[model samples]
Target: MQFTAKFNALAVAVVAAMVSQVAASPAPVASVVSTDEFLKWLDTTDADITYIGKPINGSVPRAAQDVMVTYCNKRTQNVCGGTCTVYNGPAACLAAGGTACLSATANVGFCDRGGCGGSCNQLSTCGTHLDNGFCFTPGTASIIVPPS
Candidate 1:
């Protein structure tokens, strides 16, 4: 019957429209939490935390170009644990001592020397990704923070 044929055509058109919409949607991007939230998280962690740059306070708004990096002294299984240093500030070479692993809100570079003047690797190209966005970066003695 013509009614059945028309109904089938309508269904096909609806499905086509849905498919197009889905295909046009943009891919999801990684999200970074606010400074306040990050501070709250830092408080909850058991690892010893040290700050290297700008002071962190609830009333102070984090710089837009700053990146939060947390480097740990140990990695067990796929976790970055032990004494950790939390760096929250602008782009600069960070002296990270005994850092075996690290995590960051944005991509950064890790180096083997104290001044970031040796072999370097980007976090985006991490070979050993640990739990919760942490990467295994053994022998890292410094970090290069790129401007955001």
Candidate 2:
């Protein structure tokens, strides 16, 4: 009987210790930003991508751009005479419709053909480049809401 009583007391103590330890543990912190907030900040839906080429200011969201250039190490290559800001990582990349460490981004430029004046293009491709005497200009970044 004494042994049973001690065993029961020991069991209770163990349970109590576990409960106390759990209670003392820190609350779980959010490791990643919320999806809704991320989308909002990204200013685009999963369907479409924001192409922020360089004008030193362009289509990418201010916050997302900051994160990309700062946290994601986006760089300029003059991929189109206009600077193409490429970033890979985190929610921003996914939000930008890019995958595998790259966001969906394209180059920015205009057709420099004597007859194609003002014929603009904003993709990774252009028949004209800086060497072709065509200048680059980034397009506006737009915000989008996903369909229900």
The global C-alpha lDDT for each of the candidates, from Candidate 1 onward, is: 0.81, 0.31
Tens-digit per-residue lDDT, 1-148, candidate 2: 9999999999999999999998896742222223233334344322233344232234344543232311111213522212233332233221221111122221222232222233433323422232112222232222111111
Q: Candidate 1: give the clashing pairs.
A: none
Tell me the lDDT of model 2 at 90: 30
Cα lDDT of model 1 by residue, 58-89, tens digit: 67767789888889999989777898998878
**TM values, all candidates:** 0.72, 0.24
lDDT of 1 at 58: 60
Q: Which number leads on TM-score?
A: 1
TM-score of 2: 0.24
Name the regions of candidate 2 deviating beyond 4 angstroms: 27-95, 101-148
